[model samples]
Target: MTTIEAPRSRPTRRRGVNWEKWGWLYMRFSGILLVVLIFGHLLVNLFLGDGVSAIDFAFVAGKLADPFWIVWDTLLLWLALIHGANGMRTLTNDYARGKLRVVLLVLLAGATVVLLVLGTLVLTTFDPCIGDSTVDALIEACAAQ
Candidate 1:
């Protein structure tokens, strides 16, 4: 039987950034950060206070109103999407060939960018005070603004 060879590092462009290395590093670092952010989010939203029953539009509105939560959510959105996209790209590279790989990579990148833009817009521009909601929670939240 032939011995399997180890993976080799590809040659890089002179004076250019080694993006593959950076991507690998990002995967590791972002994974650790995501665990913390995700767990914290779950604990606050699902376990504390009234638990799962407490989640609703009003609860979401309240969280989004705070700048801290807005930033927290933005980070979660960007990091998670990019991390997932990067992994997909890596998988596409490893498993796909020729035109299919190119097509998949392009599609993956386009989708990731679109989602990131939309998610960020929603998070940053969300107005809980909009619309006519009779819920006391929403009404009270709007009134305080």
Candidate 2:
């Protein structure tokens, strides 16, 4: 009868901060927050007031005029953008290889940054009176400030 050798232990690896673990955790928490934020946003915008028919430029201007809505939209923009980018990055790492993977990652990062910057700028610097002075209510509101 042949004698079997003892089983080997797992190999040692370098010690460092595990980014994948943090990323996984972030995905879970962010997903939960995103659902709440998205539903609240949809409920207020699409289901309340006059609904879809009331979604004109004036309505958007009014919404953005409030600091609460501005902050809400900014949160929505940043969280959604980063969440999507992280998901796409995970996919890229899993399925892509070589130069293709690098290129995709670079493109994804660039797009995410660009969108975040632009979206934040739009939210923070939005002037509700920039267009369409034809609406009497908007005209009065703009003049009041």
Candidate 3:
């Protein structure tokens, strides 16, 4: 029987920013921030004032009217979505194979970016007086100023 020979392998050291390490750091950082933001959100929206009974269309309109809440929510959206997407990327890498792995990663990244853009636009450009049904309410609220 002929002897089998192992294939030769080459070793090359990588340099510069360790993105995976940064990604890991980001996950931990974002996770901590998410806990604060999420809990604060739940506390304010679900437990404060009139509680769940106070949550209505007008309540949302009123909150979004303020710039502070808008910024808070925007950050929350960005951090949570990125954290979740990255976590899912880790999972996909663990389970997927070859071309399928690359495809999944691309799709995940694309979806995350699209969602972030859309969500940010919605938050920043939100016009409470857009539709007819709630236009009156928003107008009245604005006019009250």
Candidate 4:
């Protein structure tokens, strides 16, 4: 029986920046923040005041009208989308192979970008009074503005 030879290895060297380490840290921190944001969102929308029944267009308009909620929603959108895209990239790297892996990663990036742009636009440019509606309350509110 011949003896097995040990595989040769290159010496490890320090690099400029370790992005993977930072990504791992980001995942942990963002997950914690997402939990809090999600819970607070649910609490306010589904459990407060008139509960889920109060979740009409007016409700959304009211929430988005506040600068605090605008910033909160923007943070939620960016963090969650980036976190999800990074996770998918990791998964693709782990399980995918050949050109399919590249395709998947590209698709993931495109989708994430598109969603982030759309979500941010919606959050920032939301006008509750853009359309004519039969709702007197909304009409009056818009007229008052």
Candidate 5:
């Protein structure tokens, strides 16, 4: 009779930090938050008051002028961008190979950072009455100030 042997398994090592675990948690939490934020945003922009027609420059300016809206917008922007970028990173890891994967990840990170910074700046420093004398509404709004 021939002797039978069992395959040996490699030993597993415990790491100090579990980044993948944290990333998985982040995806779950961020997805939940994004759903609420996005729905609230759409409801406010498309269902409240005058609806879509009310969504013009002054409307945006008015919203951004409020501290509450500013914070809300910033949170939405950061969360959405990071969530999207992380998702893309996961996809890249799964399908991309070698240098191309690295390049795509680096570019993704760079773009996310740039967009977050620019978006935050626009939200925080927006002036409804900047250099525009054509719009009577803006002129009136600025004149009141």
Candidate 6:
């Protein structure tokens, strides 16, 4: 017995902007920006000053004290997370199979959303003095009066 093949047809055209195309463009643009942001962040935090040896809670708290560093770090976090997530989605589409692909993609997207929300909250709502001991040296040096 011979099996019959079903005929294939073209999909109808839509009359609106193609969001997928914009998303693709956005991923590339954000990826380039992330490269710069991430490297600059690393260079400043790990290579500048006394190199990695100077990286402590006090150093980070000092940086977060400034609104400029807060905005810069916040933008870096947002862009890198989004670019990295989109890159993972591309990899997932290339390798994941069948129902497992759908499940993995759903989990990735959910995790990305949760991470972005939490990261943003931390950047925006962070208080350097939140856990400071009353006698903390840096707190006395930097805390707002």
TM-score for each of the candidates: 0.83, 0.83, 0.80, 0.84, 0.83, 0.81
In candidate 2, stretches whose alpha carbon ends up further than 4 angstroms from where it belongs are 1-13
1-145 in candidate 4: lDDT tens per residue? 5555566765456777889889999999999999998888889999989899999887888899899999999999998899989999999999999999999999998999999999999998889889875678889988998
RMSD of 5: 5.7
- Each prediction's Cα lDDT score? 0.90, 0.90, 0.89, 0.90, 0.87, 0.83
- Kindly report the root-mean-square deviation of model 3 from the true structure over all alpha carbons: 5.4
Candidate 3 lDDT tens digits, 19-114: 898999999999999999999999989999998999977788789989999999999999999999999999998999889999999999999999
TM-score of 2: 0.83
Model 2 lDDT per residue over 70-107, tens place: 99999999888999999999999999999999999999
Q: What is the C-alpha lDDT profile of model 6 across 69-136, one tens digit per residue?
A: 88888898788887788889889989998899999999999999999899889988987677754547
Query: What stretches of model 5 exceed 4 Å from their correct place?
Result: 1-14
The Cα RMSD of model 1 versus the native structure comes to 4.1
lDDT of 4 at 68: 96
Name the candidate, 2 or 6, with the larger lDDT value: 2
Off by over 4 Å in 6: 1-17, 141-144
Question: Which 10 successive residues of model 5 have the least lDDT summed?
Answer: 2-11
Clashing pairs in 4: none
Q: Would you give me the overall lDDT of model 3?
A: 0.89
- Tens digits of per-residue lDDT, candidate 1, 22-124, equal 9999999999999988898999999999999999888898899799999999999988999999999989989999999999999999999999999999998
Q: Could you tell me the lDDT of residue 30 within candidate 1?
A: 99
Question: What's the CA error at residue 2 for candidate 3, in Å?
Answer: 26
Question: Cα lDDT for residue 9, model 3?
Answer: 50
